[model samples]
Target chain A: MNETSRAVGWKPRGWDVLNIVLLSLLALATMYPFYYIFIYSISVPEEALKGVYLIPRGFSLQNYVHIFKQDNILWAFFISVARTVVGTVLTLLCCTAFSYGISKRNVPFRKLMYGAVIVTMYISPGLIPWYITMKSYGLQNNFLLYILPGLMVAFYIVLIKTYIEELPAALEESAMVDGASYYQMLFRIVLPLSIPVLATVAIFNAVNQWNSWVDNLYLASDLKLQTLQMLLYTYVNQQTAALSMINSNSTAQTAFVMTPTSVQMTITMIATLPILFVYPFLQRFFLKGLMLGAVKG
Target chain B: MEKTAPRKRKIEVPLLVLTVPFFLIVVLFSYVPLWGWSIAFVDYVPGRSILESAFAGFKYFHRLFDSTSDFGTVLRNTLVLSFLHLICSPLPVLLAIMITNLRSGRFAKFIQTVTSFPNFISWIIVYSVFFSFFSIDDGMLNKLLYGTLHWIKEPSNLLSDPRWTWWFMTLATVWKTVGWTAIIYIAAIAGIDQEQYQAAEVDGASRFKQAIHITIPGIMPTFTILLLLNIGNMLNVGFDQYYVFGNALVQEKIDVIDTYTYRVGLLNMDFSYSTAAGIFKSLVSVILLFTANFVTRRTSGRSIM
Candidate 1:
């Protein structure tokens, strides 16, 4: 292609060039910090601290191994995983079912159900009251506390309802005319076409649940059931003391004890990896879901 | 044709039955706990019977606004932080617009993915990232500045400085959710009819002029709706992130309403007082939502309700 032909297309001008540069710079600034930390996690502690940018000076898996060495870290990891899976599935089933019901014109007491859901969304009984109620219900120190409270989010329901409302009513009508009952229509017609939205809500909810440590920190006094984020918090707070202990021992045996900073990064990576892996798969749907929700609101 | 002669009003038993679980869950969790709002008026002890508890009507609320409560500082922090976010939130909109204007689709997608990567990671991870960049000794930010020029003996404690913590919180928050927020605006812009832009261009408008006249006006409704919706949640700062990021040095500036409630209720065991504060926040949110909805209906001919 000739330069003039290329320029005739969308070759950016002066201001556009500046915009691109500034944007890329900001993107790098936002992104490369995490990359630096990721590299630091795998590098030897001292060298990592010395501003080595290319790669870890002395490459190692010892940091990840040290994180694995801690008791309950693995258990907390599993608990977090279990919480994400169970909480998301439950949220999907209940919220979607309720939303589907409310969206249908023929559903009984639809207005009342719709009002209840909206009320729940807009007027939460505040944190303290909820905490007190959870305590009264004897949910303290239990895994159910984390999973149950977040199982049915109203905003997610509204999003799903908005999406379902846009779906062609003729499909459901045709299914019903063919002797498919309400349940049959729901499962066979509604659920099948709702995958894009289901995946979108599922990914968003899963990320939220995985990152939710506050509920556990508030309710679960038992360390055994703490989520990964809570464990990471504990790790951040204890890093200084850990560093001192490592410095005290000059022997090579202590080299195996990875720096707490490295462990901190690893914990962050571990907590974030699932979402990162699942994001691209669901990104397009999520953006669409959010736009529809925003526009409808 | 004869089958349609009598339109039946059939009872939806299966639908009702199918919806029973939703009602049960809502009643159990939402409606039942709603009754616990009575605790705001009394000295609510978790283990004690509700009947036995002393009914100190308005006493806890009085304490919340009293001089001893540090209530002024907490409210001020929440308002300032939220107002600042309301202003700063538009930066992401601009970023999204700029990215969409770019010629390279691959670059736009890459920017979107990486910027949103932070949102998936919890505040704990953000805190760790902050430390990596701002830690006194080993931080890249400090090291790079120090290496270039010996400005000071040690790196400045960016997170600990009360004057700077709120901005740090905002930066961390924006870093995480900017792309997520931008995606909506981008979609809204995308949805604008292309014929309008063509008309503007055909009328001899420049690219910038076309954007200003055609594109922006088209997405005005989306912008207004989002603005109103965001206003509803103005007081609800991310408690987990703030609590994780806060420390002794920066607590004064960063201690928002949510964190304040947690500290008072869970840490100090002042349940009744904290409940009052929490109720106050929720009440404000409800009012904002209603007011915004009213304004939107009056001006824009649309309503969130």
Candidate 2:
């Protein structure tokens, strides 16, 4: 490709340079907000109050120290982790198993069941009905609300099923010949072979579970069930109230020094940190998963 | 084949048993909600069975169209937001083309990676980032404009300003999704036959000409399918972005159907009326989807469904 472009005497033209420059500006624009937040979180409260741009004026871990001291922050972090781990695992298991069943052409009511799942991808019963249904199911204020309703996402089911259908049937046939039960085949043969798609689904589910707070807002009102995202939303929306709550809990010296802006940035960093850490490693899989879904969809 | 057929039959019952739990879950979560649609038709009362509630016929649906209701504002916001989104749909294609045209593969990859990062973060964090930059007081933009640059005399409350709410929401959504959406177009560009590019190059077509004549046309099918899908989702301006960005000051401008439903059903305890609005939205969405599909099938000789 390089040789061909060279053969055409294709040098770095003005348009190419302009494209590169504009894209770099876009990339900077996308990244600068996060950088600004990080700098503000670490800068001295007085300096951050004046406004931070480009870099931190004074380095301090005081904001983080104060964040860690708050019990609700720690509790929300714990709840967020619990939901991501448990929710992703259950979603993978249930969605993959169900997709495996649906992949079988000879299963009774296979078309009906598969059609039902696909239909859901197009239509939703809207928010009010969905809320009413969840409330009736005793999911309000329940941890199961996070795990159960999301267990078998129709999109994930379709992705896994498409992958499973394309797999070599010989392996499953051989396993069945060995008298492997349906459970054993699913756990042993299908699940093992479906790792790529499963990894994709797992990352998608984990990120969603971590990022979601609306369910917490609407269905689960218990303080104990609050996730990190919910806490961030609360802090962002109710800045003065959150600031007072933080100041009221802190020692006088620290409270006097700490500003609401720094605390807010600190909380924002905390909520976003985990995703930042894992994104680079898992992004390729989700991107691949997306392409796979796009093709099948 | 005969031996395997018998074996398959033998385990059929177990397979059916394995599927029952998932089937039940789908029915409970997805199908059961349809029953709640009935609330829109009746005088739904809490703690009473839907069947026992007094039948109100189409009273709520009629009220949805009444000039006095908030539905008019909600519908206007929803359509305006959706239209803004539709107009900006070409951005991802533009981004994809630019990324593909880059001379350095590594820089293109870096651009893609960084731009897509925002998509993974939650809207709450996005709001936090927005607040830090655009909030009225002590926000970075305000501080810079009113303090350092003296670009403006007073701090601008970009987040709460009602006049530009639709456009601002569109910008936020585009910023969050453009990179992610471009991936599919990038994939489509990759799928375009390499021979076509080679042929164009051999014919003395400049790279710019090649992109215009070949690459843009190649990705049209994917673009069309996505546009149709967006049309199908015309009423669903999403619940999250609006919900988080909304303030009492901007409520009139930002209250799309989903947020309106949530406020009326849960906050105001008007479940029946909200259900009526929701049902109307859903019915229109389904009709739009089929209409788009039908139009595509008729015009392009292909159907999205």
lDDT leader: 2
lDDT over C-alpha atoms for residue A159 of model 1 = 85
| DockQ value for model 1 | 0.45
Best by TM-score: 2
True contacts kept of each: 0.54, 0.70
- Candidate 1 stretches with Cα past 4 Å from truth are A1-12, A100-107, A161-189, A242-255, B1-13, B147-153, B199-204
Quote the positional error of residue A52 for candidate 2 in Å: 1.1
lDDT of 2 at A186: 88
TM-score of decoy 2: 0.95
* CAPRI grade of model 1: acceptable
lDDT of each: 0.79, 0.88
